[model samples]
Target chain A: MSDEKKLAIIATKGTLDWGYPPFILASTAAALGYETQVFFTFYGLQLVRKKLDLKVSPLGNPGMPMPMGMDKWFPVLGTALPGMESVMSSMMKKKMRDKGVASLQELRDLCFEAEVKMIACQMTVDLFDFNPADFVDGLEFGGAATFFEFAGESDICLFI
Target chain B: MAAFDQELDATGLNCPLPILRAKKTLSGMEAGQVLRIVATDPGSVKDFEAFSKQTGNELLESGEEAGKFVFLLKKA
Candidate 1:
């Protein structure tokens, strides 16, 4: 085995909030000189699409803090109103911008530039009726075996 | 302050942007060349330390100036 450290991550969530961790960690690992690979499966495939449109929903997510002092007094019913998901998503995006957090697209570009391998699960693509052309270029398509080829030998493995 | 071959201003970027940009800068630099970075993110202090250790780069100088964190890193 090569002496270089390797990191493998499985991404399964497509929500805007859940999207950050995999890209952030993988890009950082690659910057650290680790051989990194991120396997996008299930809902995670949404992240690799060329037209990224991930959204966050406050519904059933009690931990999500509402703005305007709503965190302490807001009822769960507030999350069920029409267009609540878009509102929450916009608020989250604004918060990230205010904090100078990198955008998802920027992070993905960094990962690509760093040569971090990105694999899209082929089974999911078929199941979800997604075309390979829909995703960003340079993304590899594979299944469980393909992921294990790299992940099995990796020094660190994470399912995010 | 130590002499540096290049300087990067990362004042408003947060989390991994500063580090990612540093890595990109270091890649284009010759070995042993120093890169001076100025960042405003408080978390970057610890992040740079870890980055130096993990990437085998040298942290020549680490300190604060006028509410910003300054770091000098020597490419390995």
Candidate 2:
């Protein structure tokens, strides 16, 4: 509308697999010279947590394919396993590293360097008992009103 | 004259970086300039092609050389 493209990325998932979509899209939008904002809410707040790397494992997810077995026959064992998410996250990270994709930390740093705005949803932070210190520096804390204000002028709005 | 000459070595950089760098460099140049980008990432080939099409830039020459990709772009 203002001859400048705007993009808003809503991050709602905290899993490792779910973490990539928002960062990737936001980074790409910023690289394209668009006004890009990434709003972290709900479990997605874990992505911005300084201590949590947000890893996921492929095993135990009913949605994930088992190595050589049919997923449907694998039983409910998929969701019952502990630490599968982290394992999957590590595996995915390894795969990306092998293929030369930038690490999540690198991507975050690059996004900041490129001037992508990052916002943390206050409601989720309160619900999760997370403090501002838990997140990376330069993250703004706001509510739905703030998100709507930012998203009102966006040409692209995505929830990932 | 040979249009213009620019070189970009984006080897080992993945998608978006190469495209981002190229876009940044191209934005600073005048039209009709030629930019040569060298990259090793396979995804960059398609990424640059799409970038060229989307940005209205021209892909004058694109080929592979000894495991490296070479792209010649003309700013439009």
The estimated TM-scores of all candidates read: 0.97, 0.80
On residues B1-76, what C-alpha lDDT tens digit does candidate 2 reach at each position? 2344898988877876688778778878889999989899888888888878766799988889889999989998
On the 0 to 100 scale, the lDDT of residue A146 in model 2 is: 96
Residue B43's lDDT within candidate 1 is 93
- For candidate 1, the per-residue lDDT at B31 reads 98
Quantify how close model 1 is to the true structure by its C-alpha RMSD in Å.
Answer: 1.1
- Regions of candidate 2 where Cα sits further than 4 Å from its true position: A59-79, B1-7, B21-35, B53-58, B74-76
Going through the candidates in the order shown, the clash numbers are 0, 7
lDDT of 2 by residue, A1-160 (tens): 3776899989999877777788777777776668899999999898888865767755545576544464556456654567756655666777778776777777777778778899999998888788889899989999999999989989999988
Clashing pairs in 1: none
RMSD of each: 1.1, 3.6
For model 1, residues A67-151, the per-residue Cα lDDT tens digits are 8887567667877889989988999999999999999999999999999999999999999899999999999999999999999
DockQ, cand. 2: 0.46
TM-score of 2: 0.80
lDDT of 1 at A126: 97
